[model samples]
Target: MRLRTLLRSSSAVVLAPLLAGLVVLLLRADGTLHPVPGYGLSVLTAAHSALPYIAAACAGSAAWEGGRLKQGRVFEQAPARGRLGIALPVLAPVWLMGLGGYAVALVMAAVAADGTAPDLSRPPIPAVAALLLLAATLTGYLAGLVLPRLAAGPVALVGAFWVMAFPASWQTPWPRHLVGNPITGCCGVGQAVAPDTLWAAGIFTAAACAAALLTAHRATVGTAVTAVAVLALGTTLAAGFGQRMGYDGTVPRAAAELACDASARPRVCLWPETPGRTAVVAQIRTETGRLGAAGVPVPAALTQDPAGGPDTGVLGRTGELSPEEVTRTTAAALLPAPLGCEQPAREPLLGWLTAVATGEPPSDARVRAVLEQPRAAQSEWFRAGRDSLTDCGRSGVR
Candidate 1:
């Protein structure tokens, strides 16, 4: 088929609308954006999630076109151009259209990611999308050559979707990691797509492409053997090295590193990426100093740990605190230990500390009574907080 005839085909007519609808669906499905989180990363992730479907559709379209050519007996004509040359024009339109769809989705995602910077260190997700598109179409073309026209299109579509989707469902790390959607949960500001996961995905898709290309035009025994070997090798590499690191998003080590105010009497450290870094650090330093002056045993330095979680670390949620909240939170963090899981002193100890920090102790009599205790006795209660918080059945608290 000539270029003009190919462009004017019904299959080509449907490409634009299909791409547009997919892009619209993806943008709407990206969900709500929370401030101060990984806006850029999330947008990219949404694009990554949406591209697989588009690639699959393009592969199906390629199969349909291949069927049309075979039905028309174009390959039997044996014209000046070789079989691959004729096939190129037919598949090129689908390839370009698929790429165009991805480009549009990526740009839209970038717009959605506005106001937040993405970690530039993230793996090249677009590269993976390109490989998927190529692999899917090549495989589809091979299917069209072998299967009936009606069967080829749907088979290619469903087959491509299954290969991409099934791996994501497995509980095992290797399967999910090799599927190319490594970071499943929302990409928070502190996270980056793991590099090794992307590499595994790339290798898998690239190998599939090699196999598909070899099998598309010929089916010799040697070619069949080589194709199978290539595919197996790719899967092995993906499943093997793919799991060297966990598929869950990696915390950017640099972002997690403490950024501290050195001049403060009790040094205050915040996560490097904490929003409002300067103000948050200054406030924490001031509150920790106040607690220390009040004879509360504040640590020499307060370190902000985002992964430490609210009740377990010295500081957490620094990006989301008000000045007053900081004072109270800092006091809670400075408690001799995290609120213990055990009882006895739990409520009373928390009450005493809250009153000390806020000057408004809880109205509960149990809490008030702890506040009314002598300073030395109050100190003992504070010191035992960690031990009490420890889970009772485990190794006894140190």
Candidate 2:
């Protein structure tokens, strides 16, 4: 069969409108779009989350195409191409159609970001969708070869949907993270898809596709045995990759790697998408200086350090923080409340710090009383309360 003839087939015609409708529905349900930075990633995440439905449709369409081949008795006609050659023409356009859907979807997602350019780092999500389409289509083809088309089409669609959707609810990491349910919307301006997780999923889905191809092309017992062995090996290898979650926690490291502004004192750095970084940095520095002047220890640098631990006093997630919010949060960090204390008096130093950060006088009577105490008494209050506070009452800064 000529490529042109196959391209003009009924399968492509039917799938065109179906895919368009599905994509439209997905866009409508994609919820409100925030105008924060990393607009590209948020759009990609929405697209990634819709893959199971797209893949389900692909599986059904592929099964129908397979049935058409078997029903026409293409094998008996013995066209110029053998079984594999004939099947290739029937399958290629549909697979390409599925890939085309992702391309169109990527464009729509970019538009949905409301003028913000999405990160074009080529996330592994589209590749994952492509591999899943191949796996589902090939599996459907194998079924179509055995069962009648009427039964195979629906079965493959439902089965593929279940395979993709059910694992999302699984508690185990292998099924939850590796089973194709996207850990999407987690990647923001400063975050990325976990490379190890993406690689493992790619390996797993590729193995499944290969096995389906082998089963559809070779019916021999040896081929079947080999396919099962390959699948098992792939599964074992994927399991050993040790991915704890489907997506990595967002880190400011990606932003730090980008162009950093060092003009501010204490040299505050931020992600490109971080709103009002200079203002927030200035406010934080001022608040930290106030803390220091009040005899409270403050970190010299106020930056987002990916590797910094709790004691490092790292200011984080500047994209979400306002300038005043940063001031308050930084003040709290400099003089944090003790946990689980039964002390009756409010911690005067912390109240004063909060008052200074927010430009408000301390209102509570106990806090007011504590502020009137001598400097030594206030110091003793700070130290004594630190030990007396249990794990529950963390801060008395209100």
Candidate 3:
């Protein structure tokens, strides 16, 4: 079939509305990407966000095409082309339509990042997404060959969505990782998509596509056996690899050169993509100075980099930098780091420290009582609270 004819007749003609919907979804979903505009993160997020919709559309369209082929007896007629050749041309438009949607998503991500260059160090999420979509298309086409024409499209549509979406809710974290969803918690500036996650998705989707193709082409018995063995091996490896990843399929990103303001007493460092650095640095300096005057020990440096020392305080990784945000981060920095174990007794002290750092009155009655004491007495109590923060056994407030 000619390219023009295939496009005109294929479901790609009606995909405009779907693509438009995808664009809207991309824009709305990209709000979190705005603060950290790393291209690799943006691209990965866009691909995962767009996957469910694009996969459903591709699968449904391919199913319809498959039904049409079956109804026309294309397979039975022994046409000039073989089964694989005939199906490929018919399904080409659907596959290309899906790819077009992914392209649009990438463009939107780039736009969201204000055209920042991609972090090339990160895994190839977009490529993995393309492979995953190809597997979905083939799976749907296979469904059409077996089911009644009226049932194939709807079945493929629902099944594709379920496969892409349902795993996210599973108690077992690995299943979601194996699917093309990537990771939702992915990619603060300090994080990257785990390489194992990409490998798992790639392996599974590639295996699925190969199996579907072999079946569609009517392989010999020996070929079928080989394909099944390969499929099983791929599944085992993908699942094992995915199980080892964190729930969100991310890892601490490798260190990169940061933008730092060295003029301040405690140097302030941030990701290069962070906006309004001058304002952020000023706020940090002002807040830290106030805390120091109040007898709180300030760190030697404030950095947003994940690899910074325990003594170094961290700034917020997302959102616009503001005075309130700076004050909160600075105050929290003065406190002991969370031990992950609960320490409810520390709430009053935490509240008091935050109030002092921000120059706000304490809201809690217990904290207010502490503030009413003389400056020397209050400092004693504050020092005790800071020192005992990690002592979970000390349930009584000082």
Quantify all predictions' global Cα lDDT against the true fold. Answer: 0.68, 0.65, 0.75
Q: Please tell me which predicted candidate would have the highest lDDT against the true structure.
A: 3
What is the per-residue lDDT of model 3 for residues 198-305, given as tens digits with 9 covering 90 to 100? 888899888888988987787479767877887898889899889887467877655564787889778888766566768878877876787678777788888776
lDDT of 2: 0.65
lDDT of 2 by residue, 81-180 (tens): 6677778778877777677666666655666665555555765766776887788778777777888889988987898788877876666656544555
Give the Å error, residue 257, model 3.
5.9
Sort by lDDT, best first: what order? Answer: 3, 1, 2
Candidate 1 lDDT trough over 10 residues, lowest sum: 30-39
Tens digits of per-residue lDDT, candidate 1, 1-398, equal: 56677789837457767786877676666363232343555566656666667767877888898898889888778766767777878888887777778777766666665534444445477677788788888888888888999999999989888877777666676776666766544355445567777778788889998987777656689889999999999989877757786646454434344677778666676755566777877766655565555566766666665444333336644555676667666766664454344455555555565667666658778666656778776666566654555545433212
- Model 1 pairs in collision: 38-189, 340-389, 341-389
Q: TM-scores of all models?
A: 0.78, 0.83, 0.82
What TM-score does candidate 1 get on C-alpha atoms? 0.78
Clashing pairs in 3: none
lDDT of residue 347 for candidate 1? 53
lDDT of model 1, residue 34: 35
